[model samples]
Target: MFDPTAFDNIKFMIQAEVYDRDLAGLFHVHSRKDLVDLATLSRESVITFSLKDSADLRVSLVVKADLEKLAGELLPSSNALPGVSLHILYFGTERSLMAERMDLLEWMWGTERRYERKKIDSDQTGTTYEWHVYFERIITEEMMDELGDLISFIGESLRTVTETE
Candidate 1:
């Protein structure tokens, strides 16, 4: 399950640079009011309603040369970066049911051989077959965790095979 509240406090930083004065002409068709309106709606506080509509969301411009000075105190370089990618495979009983419930498909069809019991009448019963199939991939924390473990297992298996050879 994906939780929207996990990112409630996260703040995103964006910086843009325009090289030439002629580039400023590109916005000639858009009035200053249009730019202000767009920016007002895009601000984190405004979009999330963290603050009132009157709150200031204006960003102060900094010269490229000044960025180095600011970076020395505010940002630090990292020696190593973490590399991780997650892949999820979702499974459901029926294609139509999965599509209706989550808009996904059934994957690895006809794998399970188990049969389930279903009631046909008060004195009789019937057997029903079911298989877990997945059509789409969903990215979430739980799925990522499972993917990480699966990847680790595959990596270890490959390493062992190569070492023996």
Candidate 2:
């Protein structure tokens, strides 16, 4: 059982042991293009994070988790355990009004093109983004089924290609 108290205490948790660095997801994107032209020509907001390697003995240096998918699996049940009201607080969506309000930010910058002129303002300098998610369930047989299926698939798929390799 996961301790709910840990959520209030820990701000972040480090993930460990990932096999492939080249692939970002179940899919792949392979190409290089102008960042600016892509932004104007495309809708995706690109961001990158470069991590410094750690030398700690306990750290093996790879992390992978599809929490977005996992959260989808952990939906709230209509009925919950007695005295344990399982709360699945999902944000990063319209349901989270406070989170949405906090994310309301306007970006300001000098426009190089006439098309972007009116939108750019000097006071605001960057885009705003908000995200939140939660998973909840009382210990139950049906809940175990969801977890079992997810575990079985991951274990079978990311396993060895060759025996004893």
> How many pairs collide in each candidate, listed in order?
4, 1
Question: Per-residue alpha-carbon lDDT of model 2 for 60-151, expressed as tens digits?
Answer: 11111222322333445423232111111111222222332322211111132111111222355532222221123322323433433432
Q: Write the per-residue lDDT of candidate 1 for residues 45-139, one digit (tens) a residue.
A: 11110011211111111111122322332345733221211222221223212232221112212333221222222234322222222223222
lDDT of 2 at 65: 22
After superposition, which runs of candidate 1 have C-alpha atoms over 4 Å from their true positions? 1-136
By summed lDDT, the worst window of 10 consecutive residues in model 1 runs over 10-19
